[model samples]
Target: MPRYFTDEHEWIDVEGDTATVGITDYAQGQLGDIVFVELPRVGSEVARGKDAAVVESVKAASDVYAPITGEVTEANGALEDDPALVNSSPEDQGWFFKLTIANKSELDGLMDAAAYKSFCDSL
Candidate 1:
């Protein structure tokens, strides 16, 4: 299992120093139908807890935060053509980016799945 989560409701699956990042099921459910996703450029530097991208739904736009400090490696370009993948598979096909983490220690500040669930419950 992956240690994942952010206060912004982002989820991350870290593998070594690289990670795949995305929003949570609860987030997508609230966002409704995803129509557009503005992804960050590859190689962009992102600070933990800062806005890294934007996800726009039929309802509104929300900032997607960097769960950990990292250099963006790739983004879901497929979102440019079809954004519904976010609604159908927020954890899998809808993953937003892959990152090359700058500081592995940053992971310590993130919440694990159990903690994330608790945090969501509190929200």
Candidate 2:
């Protein structure tokens, strides 16, 4: 699966119309130790660049923005029980939600792995 990232440090992996969304490893590091995750409800509509979830860490709470417009299909329940999964496996098991993409074109504005890496390095 190809992964895309946003300036806000959210990463999204898309397969067909379904997408898995999460914060990048860099994001978790900045947030410190994660304590809680507030997820969006299934079937909720989300617009690109808008808040879809909130991650609370020892440092502060931060919004996880939707990288593409879509209706949420699922939220990661595992985080509710072990929010620290975000710190340990941010790009894998720590994913926040899945969405059924509403517009494929929205992806064009996002950065690919190479671009995102450079974006992070410049930060």
Candidate 3:
């Protein structure tokens, strides 16, 4: 899997034409304790840079943007029961959704792990 990051702090792990999406660990850390997540409905169309989900934490509610345009295939059901997973395992089990990518070219504009780290460092 090739992982990419958005300036907005979202991460996507691409595998074939399907990709899994989530907020970066840095995002979870900044949000404090997560309380709820409003995931995009499966089969819904998502546009790159558009809001795909919402995460609510003790500090505030934040939109989770789509890193690439696609049709959502799955949304993490675990978040409904344990939103804190976004805090505990943000890069792994805390994943938000999976989608069938609509445009692979959009990935070229995203940052790789090292670049993302540098971007976060500069912030």
Candidate 4:
């Protein structure tokens, strides 16, 4: 019911057995200007806590990891043409993918909003 975020600054919204995943606003801010995004193919299998994609920004390149084991069901192809959306809306329209969650138990290892906020502050 609540959003979760990783120490690396990726965020996820889990609903039922599915999850919507993306980089956080802070991540985009740290990355500066996003220029390119390399996303996983739909249907690709992703392991829990593994790198599943890469976002290349003007400042640097960062990998996006799977919040939990899952299959990529959808990718935001819109980023191909307009990566700036990530800078403007990291939590909304900039979402990178929709995953068909495969290892729900892995969610337990993820940080809830409050924890994530503290984690963000630590960075």
Tens-place lDDT per residue, model 3, 46-118, is 9998999999998788888898999999999999999999999999999999999999999998999999999
Candidate 4 overall Cα lDDT vs. reference? 0.86
Choose the strongest candidate by lDDT.
3
Worst 10 residues of 4 by lDDT: 101-110
Q: Root-mean-square deviation of each candidate, in angstroms?
A: 1.3, 0.8, 0.6, 1.3
TM-score of each model, in listed order:
0.92, 0.96, 0.98, 0.92
Residue-level lDDT of model 1, residues 26-121, one tens digit each, is 899989999999988999998887899898987789988788888999999887888889889998899999999898888787888899899989
Model 4: per-residue Cα lDDT over 75-105, one tens digit each: 9988888988999999999999889887677
Instruction: At residue 15, give the lDDT of candidate 3.
Output: 98
Ranking by lDDT: 3, 2, 1, 4
Stretches off by above 4 angstroms in model 3 are none
**Global CA lDDT computed for model 3:** 0.95
TM-score-superior candidate, 1 or 2 = 2
Q: Model 3: which residue pairs collide?
A: none
Model 2 quality (TM-score): 0.96
| Segments in model 2 whose C-alpha atoms lie over 4 Å from true places | none
Q: Identify the runs in model 1 with alpha carbons over 4 angstroms from their true place.
A: none
